[model samples]
Target: MSHHDEEIDAAGRADEFLQVFKKGAEFTQDLLKENERLRFRVVQLEETLKEKGHDTVDESPDAIELKKKIEVLEQEKEEILGQIKVVEEENQNFANRYIEIEEENNMLANLYIASYQLHSTLDFKEVLQIILEIVINLIGAEEFGVLLLDEKTNRLEPVASEGLVTSELPSVAVGEGIIGEAVHSGENYFIDSMEGYERDFEKPIVCIPLKIKEHVIGVIAIYKLFTQKDEFTNVDYELFTLLAGHAATAVFSSRMYSDSERKLSTIQGFIDLLTK
Candidate 1:
């Protein structure tokens, strides 16, 4: 309203602009560090490929185009002005990503805690059920299952499952279905859409094989309502893979302990008879 008031408002706006610019600068610094790491990784990969007698497309037309795009991005990053509000917004974007990741990390940690409690094995079935429940909670999948292979017959039988009918799955031969193939090959599999596996499912699915000592003992399958190639990110893959590894180890250890206790009890019976 007055000259003094107008001057004060302008100064406040200036302060806000400076804050945003600082945040933008911080974001730029982080991006540059990440780019450097990526470039070094690319160089190492290229050298490894060349050593393995593979031809590199680094000098190809597509690569040149990619380089031009990177240059454009760099130019844009440099041209961004020192506006504090804009930098603050950029910082907010970064903060949002960090928060999302933190939430995911907390969830995964909870899953691990629940899984670790299964190590006791006083009631192994209950522990497995809890783990299955957590899987659904974390992944938001429609249905899921844990399938263990019958060693003698190589048949995949559902040891634990959630949201699927009891009679739906069991006794699948290795490499027969998507889940079977993942188990047989000891690798994770994804069916972008389950059109071909038309028995019942029609959704996007991910199957992780639980293998110990190079033998796939079980599988963990996730099913979603819709199908999309990019539904799950690389971070999801990493987390799921780590969980699968823990599941494999837990199953193997439980089996080993149970078997050993059985054998020891049998030997104790013989000792008692001879002593008497």
Candidate 2:
């Protein structure tokens, strides 16, 4: 009975050892499969990094900040271009204003010179000469005449003539020709082209009336302008106004002074004779 029991026990122990060995072999096979799967996943991540053109997978914060700075710089460039255009326009305006101011100063200087020369002398003959000089030199006139109204007939007669070969000017009443019309109206009349007054004179340019207060004393007739002068500007009209108001009065004062001196000399001689 003891031998049979011992044999049965040895057989059961052998069966249990076989079962434990089988389970351990199965666990080792599963661990090998999981290691292969992890290696495949690592290879896939490396390929994705290559396709995106990056050594690492994630983008840093500094790279995003640099992109924003580039956009801001492009916007600033557009603003600077607009400012440059505005500065160019302002420079052009300043240049135009400078030219206008220079022209005004030159006109003022010319007026002052004319005024000083007209009042420098009291002699009647010298005054007539001065008037001719002003027309020929200062006014840049080629042909001109000084016509005075005769008190007896109330007709305009040329007292002085320049750049013309005629012996005497044509007779003109106070309201007849262009010169006479200005004398009667006491205002300056301007003709733009030679075609306007071609019948009266070859090229009558302007006629300025000489007035002393309310009365017109004479007229200054300008037949033709200088070759360089194309037309009369506003500066020329201002000069005409100055001459009309001042020149006539200057001539009248000189004549009155001369007549008074002659009368005084005659009375003094008579008194000396009576005393002797």
Which one is best on lDDT? 2
Model 1 clashes, total count: 5
Residue pairs with backbone atoms closer than 3 Å in model 2 (clashes): none
| Tens-place lDDT digits, model 2, residues 132-245 | 887777678887888888889999877777886444566578888677788788878887565445435522468888889879888888887777987777777877887887
* TM-scores of all predicted structures: 0.56, 0.70
RMSD of each: 34.0, 13.3
Candidate 1: the clashing residue pairs are 17-84, 20-84, 20-87, 20-88, 21-84
Local accuracy of candidate 1 as per-residue lDDT tens digits, 1-276: 999999999999999999999999999999999999999999999999786653334666777789899999887776675466688899999999999999888766866665666564634565576557556655555577777888898887777777786456555788887777787788888776555454343222788888666877788777642333425655567657765776777777776777788899999999999999
Compute the lDDT for candidate 2: 0.78
Please give the distance, in angstroms, between residue 137's alpha carbon in candidate 2 and its true position after superposition: 2.3
Query: Which regions of candidate 2 deviate over 4 angstroms?
Result: 1-74, 165-167, 195-203, 271-276
